[model samples]
Target chain A: MKKMMYISAVTEALAEEMERDESVFVIGEDVDIDGGVWNETAGLLERFGAKRVVGTPISEGAFTGLAAGAALTGLRPVVEFMYGDFIHVAMDQVANQIAKARLMFGGQAKMPVVIRLCACGAGTREGAQHSQFLESWFAHLPGFVVVAPSNAADGKGLMKSAIRSDLPVVFVESRQIYYDIQDVPEGEYTVPIGKAEILRPGEQVTLLSFGYACEKARQAAEMVKDKVDVEVIDLRTLKPLDTETIFKSVEKTGRLIVAHDSPAMCSIGAEVVRRVVAERFDYLDAPPVVVASKDVPIPFNDELEDYTVLSVQDIVDEIMKISVGII
Target chain B: MKKSSVASPSAEYFYRWMLAIRHSEQKLKELYIDHKIKGALHLSIGQEAVPVGVCAALSDGDKVFSTHRSHGHYIAKTHDIEGIMAELLGRATGCSNGYGGSMHLYNYEKGFLGGNGIVGGGISLALGAAFSAFYQNNGQIGVTFFGDGAANQGILHETLNLASLLKVPFLAVCENNGVAATTPVEKSTSETDRTKLAKAYKISSLSADGSDVEAVYAAASKAVAHLRAGKGPFLLNLRTCRWEPHCGIIKDTRDQKMLDDWRTNHDPLNVIAGRYPELLSSELRAEIGREVDARIEAAVAEAMTAPAPELAEYKRNFGV
Candidate 1:
């Protein structure tokens, strides 16, 4: 195992996957000479050359659509949407054309395209246009595999798995953690889609989250170490959710707290809360407390932006609030 | 009578396919009036020559992404008359297993990507397919067929620019039928000439009389040859006419004199028959007519009996 930055892990994953499969290539604005706006795809242009690492015009709809069309014709194209918020510009290509092609065409075509985007909502002062996290929007759509890995290891492994997948996948990454370093396993490895990893095991409270919120939940778990024995489950895949892992943890803990960076309304946490209530109503000792950002647009001011987003204190308070009398 | 000098050996096949499209659409109209095939149907009655000409220029490996008015495109490419009939009628044996109706025809093996519902949506799709061919180093070209309304879409401009910039082997054929649903092109678009839009993107383009299959064939052959030689994307703006309403059964809502003029001068079958009546002899015309009618009739009967999609089939398609 070697310690690597989150951005390095992603670039390494793309490099390894492209080397492994000749059909896999990266297409986006500034991916060639600029080496990606975030530099996650840096040095790939020199390694793969112009044809493989293409620099497209800032036409999101056209390029995203080009990836989909290429995927249908036997190329695994990883489309880079500089910001997750920009995905709305190409939603028709994502939701209508790419998603519906296989099903509406009676399963004649397989869409093997991955849309990688930076979805961090706080810090960097990038303002509202670039900082919104919209994974819930994609999870609601059929024929898409939505994933957001919180750490470098999972980021590299999940991206590899997403590239290998035959269906369309939306792999959301964070700008906040691009330089954050973590120990990633050496050699080829793939974290399977639609599975959860239990970071910490305990019996009092089950804390579930994904993306950057997973890190916040881990930090909160440490803060409330003496108050509540918290079990943190990282939901790797949002669409084909590992309900089994969630249910099993909830069964043992008898209390739940869902956390994510997006707004509380109809977010991934809301879906998790709904599923637990629907499937395991009897196992719950208290209502599932969801710790999510306030429902509002991300403000430009750093202080206001921090106020609207989730924090470790928020997770800790929610965990203690749900696990009443455990202290 | 004026004669056609275009005498390729494939003229017989082109006439048969065009006649097949014409007869099948007529049958679908009768079925729609009888309340058999439900939903909106965009019949390409007067614009059969565009698809026939463009498809004749393509090989089996090439792909065509079509628009909502796509019956002619589907028929010309695969000649799968039965599958298309079943698809329109929403039968299990349909190319899309009864899921895709008239506006959503798809057949991957024959390389008919789809009849997309969105205007100008197929341009990016076809461009992507062309890019894929270039990536694989395979000598395959992609053709997209859209209407005049789709020409005004922003994605068309974007795709045109991108396709030209990348120099992908692609063809964008605009079957300019003059009207978009109910609105005329003059009222809707400021730039009436769509080929100018292509030229602005630095892509080479040409225009042809869409009703004249020989002329359309000549234009498409030239464009296909250019694209095949690694030149770049080419655009063909076909001036054609639509003989039916935008959707549903053919209604007499169009101008009587205009419709009559188009029927007289630009009717695809009449244009060929008038030019070289011997090319379609009385016996050959009757034979083609009987064959088309019998095939459509048999397909309709089988489709009526074909089973509907089940719950498991839906689950399988969703990959659940």
Candidate 2:
């Protein structure tokens, strides 16, 4: 059986990596003392000492910057930000220093820095300030390897790869998938970043999704199967995106639909669509579609938030509309 | 454990370093006035003693972290005024290869970790460097220099707390030049005693007169000793005056008389050097001017002549 929540997968990944690499450790706020805000980092602190399982102050920029500094110097630091929103405070460290350090120095530095964040605006009534789909923002940045894992298996596998990878990696987790259970093999299994997984293969239409949107895409693909054949591809990693696979699928089916939980405007979906239009324009029989959340504030009320967020049916309906030419 | 005076030569050297920095700034101010320089450059005119005193005491293994107004720290740490000049000029031969201009000077071999552009940004970064020094068991002491404005940054206090709690072998210096930008310290906070704040983190903290070379040197010596003895993080608040109105081409004129008075009375280099009857003025001034001019000239020439970083350079990444 696979674990459900993205947090649990992250926990399993951290545990396994810490066991493997002596220098690997997690440093962040409320991580050791409180087992993390979402209860993802539970019990790892007890296993690791105060030295390894560092409980830092409210200074997100410091600990994150500290992790980058440590990674550059010697140790492999897996720094966690409680929310993706707080990354803005440490963007200078993340962008200018950490991301560009290795490349800026003409490869003299490795920058084995793995920055993790509880990402995506999944509806839990957290309101506007707390919720934002910031994956695309990082994906746009050069030298930043952006990862958005969907299932439990990918979480541990991708994280392990992130720690081992020489480049700077941003391992973002979907808050909505932390508790969701899926069967993950009980041993060490590494997932290669930049490889997109084909969840379900079909011929009529191709659906690109990742993170929380994977669940919706799967459901939508299933429901619209009788009407149109749906091929769902989970882009586990956004940067170093499996563009070859995405374009190949587009070549086969001559149709594509991109969906993500982030705001639709200037998002990954938009970028993907632009790339498809520019590179693979001749392969498409019709304009490639996108199913994403509205460009507005994520609400505090549960129902309103749910209304704002994507659903399996929404993906299905949007794809069907494009396929059927109802819109 | 206690304050001690720097050697007579060391005190004189401090004066020389201060003069060099001043002349460098004067040269740059002309450039800024001439519209040759781009970007905001924060010059450390009065806060010279902190870097000179601290760098004089630290061994080669010790690391330095500095704030936006960081030319003095970089010069004090590396003593390469030429690299600093090329850097401020944004020349290709400059440290960081002209990628990081005035505020982001770096020379890891010299243990000049960086001249950080962000205010109070380098504090935690220094803590990590200190942690590396600890983990590597190199006994390397990390010192991060911040402006009085950076004291108000909440992250700095947090890092101080962590550094103290973990007993990280590091030192934090707050160059309290009475102002954070245009706002004076009196307007910034009611609690004038910043040393008390560091003490709250259980780290040994003290306020010292930043202008006098002896006073700053004595405080830095004690602070560095405590850190070297495995006593963990230490804080030193330096109360100095910005001899220039923040930087060249000043707009704000709040207290011109007070500022003028400070510039006249608190000549930091002179304050310590003047008290020494053993030193002669003409000889020292001649030597100082000669060295300063040589440094400034070499740095500018190197920067101006150096090739710019190729546009193709940033496109490549490290291959595994």
Candidate 3:
């Protein structure tokens, strides 16, 4: 048994991959001396030295490209963009180069790189500039594997698998999950990417979410237990999504509700709806519903920000509405 | 940065690269005029010293990732003239099977990783490649090249911050020609000197005369040497001149005059070829020209003979 937290799980995952594969290493801001912005990589520099745990210049585009080159040259690299939004700067590296290199090059190249991004808004008073959920932006890309684990075990196992996968992986970790601890085995383990875990078994309504939203969804599941049987799905990997589990659950339950902190329009939610509507249209008793952040920039004020985002009450209320055919 | 007198043999190679690129420019311009090529082209007519100087410092194992303006990088790293030409011609034999056009040439055998279309995009990826170099314990490095316009991109600065803070063994070469689209570097950037921005990362940094082959070579050589000796990531700004009207054609006579003046008076290849008439006639020069023309003709023929990727084949590339 291990008592490691989510952040520690992330560190262990990277360290394990680095030890397991000679071609695996890490680079990002404050990763060497400070052990990364979130302390996930603490003590990594002392063990790996400056070469493997490389600190970079303030050139996101250049370093992102560097990582892609490294990935192409047979290295499995995990690069951290301190904030999720900062990934936009290195969009060329992730979306254009690393994501498209394999397909664009006619399968002549293999891009096995992991990009780690810390998404803010974990009930921390960090303001709008620092707090925004951008997983939908990356989920829109085809070649990328987006991982966001809400639990400690999934964080370690999924990250390890991401580093090992023969594709560009973007691991989105929630700031809320750092100290969030759960039971985990000390033995080596790997969680498969592109598979959603059914956290709770139910028969009335299915709630889909990942990362921080999973916890809220679980809470909403409890809140609506007497009202309806709400099945909760932890969609750890956003891209190359496990639509099978979702659709299967929706087919059985005849109702679906997607709950995430990200925006609604043109979001991962949109893709999920498209997938279900395309394949399992008759399964839905009514139009599927999505509870998400408002379609606007995340505000600075605490109350407004909270109002803009989804909560257990909001999710439970959405479930109640679906139960009563109110929506 | 290392400064040298203009009479070195390496200087000749640099100048020749510039001239060959110019020839490519002239050919591309004529093609555009003849309506043989489509899409907006971003030519590297005056930026010869950058690719030649930096690539000269790297070995075959060290990889290079480039941008939409990538013809110079393609030529600098390898001799895939036919493949590149076919790509420009939108032939099935093109590097990307005519799917990527000019912005996605990928030649892995020669360590040319990719030609990306996004600005400031491939930097982290290059750093990742260097990370692999460091992990594999390979005596190799990854060189990622971008432009001055890319500097304004937030990712470029973030990548620098991470590379410096992490000490990744990647080298960043900024070919600053003072333009991002129609916007000049001075107007867009509060600090026109990009090297200073690199220095803020507190990593090893330098700026060089990007137009001068010898200068860029010296600076890049030192950085590569530092990388070879197990130093961290390094940043270098190449202060060069762009001798084309962005690419292909220009309606502005002033732009045309600038392009013409740069082509005629400041041709890097002609500068060296003029200096070394003996070397100019040497077997190496003959080999380069012959190789270039033959490859170009082969590509044109291949493109003309081949079929476009059929609709049935679109599923292969499009991931439908």
Q: Where in model 2 is the C-alpha error above 4 Å?
A: A1-8, A34-39, A85-111, A119-121, A124-133, A141-143, A180-188, A300-302, A325-327, B1-9, B252-254, B279-281, B317-320
Those runs of model 3 whose alpha carbons end farther than 4 Å from true positions after fitting are A1-3, A33-39, A55-66, A82-92, A296-306, A325-327, B1-20, B46-58, B119-137, B144-242, B253-260, B278-291, B307-318
**What DockQ, on C-alphas, does every prediction get?**
0.70, 0.36, 0.46
lDDT for predicted candidate 1 compared with the true structure: 0.87
- Tens-digit lDDT track for model 3 on B1-320? 22222232354466556556666656666676778878867788778878888887776678787887988888777756677777777777877677677777878777788787877666666766676666666767777898877788776777677666556578889888777766777678898877688778777878887766767888988888887777788888887777665655764333566667766875556555666777676666777776666656666776777777676777764557
TM-score of each: 0.97, 0.90, 0.84
Task: Report the C-alpha lDDT of model 1 over A1-327, residue by residue, as the tens digit.
Answer: 899998989899999999999999999888886777778888988999888998989899999889988997899999998888888888778888998888777777889999997755565567788888879988888888999999999999999999999999999887777889899988797999999999999889999988888889999999988878999999989988999999999999899999988888988888999999999999999989888888888888879988888888888888878877767
Candidate 1 has a DockQ of 0.70
Candidate 1 chain B least-lDDT 10 residues: B1-10
Best by DockQ: 1
Against the reference, the lDDT scores of all candidates come to: 0.87, 0.79, 0.77
Cα deviation of A48, candidate 3, in Å? 3.3
Which lDDT value does model 2 have at A153? 89
Whichever of 2 and 3 has more TM-score, that candidate is: 2
